[model samples]
Target: MSHHTAAKLSRSIISRLGTRGFSVNISETTQTFARLRPAFAIRNLSTSVSPNGSPKDEKNNSISSDKSQNDKIIPSYWGVAPAKLTKEDGSAWKWNCFRPWETYTADVSIHVTKHHKPENFRDKFAYWTVQALKYPTHLFFQRRHMCHAMLLETVAAVPGMVGGMLLHCKSLRRFEHSGGWIKALLEEAENERMHLMTFIDLAKPAWYERALVFAVQGVFFNAYFLAYLASPKLAHRIVGYLEEEAVISYSEFLKDLDNGSFENVPAPAIAIDYWRLPPDSTLRDVVVVIRADETHHRDLNHYASDIQCQGHELKDAPAPIGYH
Candidate 1:
């Protein structure tokens, strides 16, 4: 081939490779062309190396640097896939964490509240039940929101587990699916349990508080079970209101932290791992994320109530899995 034709063929091949996400370094291509004919290659091929570096080289380095940074930022544990297991009878079994569809953020703020009238029997019942529990919590705990949170999480975890269990049984009995509500509720229960675990590391509850947790869990579990049986709509509405109070309480906790009323201790290891928080995260960071979780629960329970009010089962719609 003539020297001119050879140069044209090489340019065409390079363009085709570039279209397929491939690139040839200009210097390398020039060297290859030099082997064909020194004078022609030197005349046709030219490359500029700037003071910093070649622009193409810098761009490639920057892309690789970005990929490495992202890999470091996102931990492997964030959304791990499950491994399959074999049952005793050789049947396949698998279980995994509920991964959220969207990234978790502590910056988003959502506050929702519901007012229950004294004349409305069901609303009144739920209102008093939540108030009866909240008044003592505030009066006793006062500024000790960490301990209060530990206690509250213990109770909060109960409703989801109970709701999930009931729904599972109902699904089996009625031969109908619950639109994944059981799995969603179970995931919520687990998430709340992790919150309790995280707080336990921060605040050691007093013996009385431990007893309080036990007594409260016992009574509340049975009461909530009966309440859910009687009316799932009322149960969900009550949880929604309870979560609103949680957001308020956490907001107060944040205020206290900012005012230096509460020491800004390093966040627990569990909190850091679960929330993918920065290495230097403090108790205030933990509270911010926990408050976000409560907000999510508040919205979800209210949505559930709305579905029930529309004369439809939770099975009629998809549950917000891994919302927290």
Candidate 2:
């Protein structure tokens, strides 16, 4: 008949009802149970007086509730649990970074390909610039897709941050909102950074490669900032083209992995936790997810360029908040 006993009984009943797929409206159910609490207390008093009402059952139920609570720590996009943590290593759940509305698969197939060609002097310059960088990477990293991905991610994470920062500043200066573009671009930047982090655990970059990341990031960050300032449209178009190349590179990575050219090492724990991947996931699984993210970024940046091409500000259209 105690308050503790009543609370435990209510929880047990609710848990059983949920498991059985009962269509109980939770608020209404709670109210109904609250009204019946007096009856429950009376029943409990009688039951406790009987020989069959063992304290062992009560102990077991309490333990079950504690276990359930311990197991309910759902992970957020950053691979940490949603709840405030009191200690490290307390998270009990894992979830994929993709939002509920986002499709977690690559939009483009390896069979479907596109090659950007020179439409004008500017287009020629962009196309040639990307190709110049791309071929050298292909030559340098040849069969080492992990290193290739690591380097590409370093460059890839730049545009979104720069674009986001510029858009944020413009919004503040103009006293206008950016139609969610700033948040969307920042999220994209963070996602790309996570890709780099995951690859770091998988590939364990050498000292030279670490040095290369610093140099590339430094130069590219400044270049991209200036480029975005000069023409946001062109900057977006360049990123779109870069993402297209990324898709192709990832396609090659997948092919090599599938052909047994690279060891199908078990996926890193960070990857598994971040992507909510199966415990038995491998590097191929991680690549598939990263390639999908790049495809989404490609589509988004190209869409932004199209808006600009049509003589509309990005603020005129709603940004895809969780496209991937």
Candidate 3:
């Protein structure tokens, strides 16, 4: 193709990609694309890149050095895909750590090793225990606010997830491993029940504030889920977005588990592994397990989108007012 024709085609492709929320710089992405032409010639191109000493292409030269600086100040990449400003998982970690092990004093006073006054020791212990209990409660309130923020932040993603899921499902239909996708959905559905139940069992009257916050979340999430079924194309994107939310939510739970300081987390008997990290002691293992099912869910929706079959089946959205 001629240089003019190729550049025109590149711009057209960039415009289409932007509509789908792919927002890297067109010229830069196009240059990258050209470099990978040989790889795309074969099916199943890897999305990852390895560092290589390839010469700067014409597009890079055309752009000014200040372009990168300008891009950094824009608060977005070409004004398409939105950024996640607050890290909910990191917030969860902070809340969990604000209160470590709960401190309580023994009736029988033990002599202090460093600071020897028994009364002073007892007073310090009491003050710290009261403070510890309040810490988680305060943190929980902050988390509730943040959860609200996330829903607002990701509102635009609704259509994108729905569309993406449909595209993914349609693409996966040719593969024989379709049943696993259904199984993953079933598992997530079942887990929601336990999650609600656990919340009810441990939730205190004061926790109603948090519950109200979650109820609002339920409205958005349930509607999104319904839309997924009503329109699988949209549903796919909704679920994909939900999976991302789940990753953040569960990671927060894991951080709380490590600290062992939830204000009202249930006893082990009430809910097995209710507040504990997954059996394996590594963060990688926890993240992997949490992400795997979501990925499976994403894959299944992708496959579902691929399927040309149709139905108006509806599943009830999870309740908006669960104790959790």
Model 1 misses residue 44 by how many Å?
85
Which residue segments of model 3 deviate by more than 4 Å? 1-141, 144-187, 205-218, 259-267, 273-324
RMSD of each: 19.6, 17.7, 26.0
Global CA lDDT computed for model 2 = 0.77
Best by TM-score: 2
Per-candidate clashes, comma-separated: 0, 0, 11
Please give the distance, in angstroms, between residue 321's alpha carbon in candidate 2 and its true position after superposition: 0.8
Estimated TM-score per prediction?
Answer: 0.66, 0.67, 0.31
Model 3 per-residue lDDT tens digits across residues 168-273: 4644775433333333344444333333443344433345555654664566556665665565644543344344444445556556556754332324222323
lDDT of 2 by residue, 122-151 (tens): 556666777787887788788889998999
Off by over 4 Å in 1: 1-107, 111-120
Better candidate number, 1 or 2, judged by lDDT: 2
Best model per lDDT: 2
The candidates, ranked best first by lDDT, are 2, 1, 3
Alpha-carbon local distance difference test for all models: 0.76, 0.77, 0.39
TM-score-wise, the better of 1 and 2 is 2
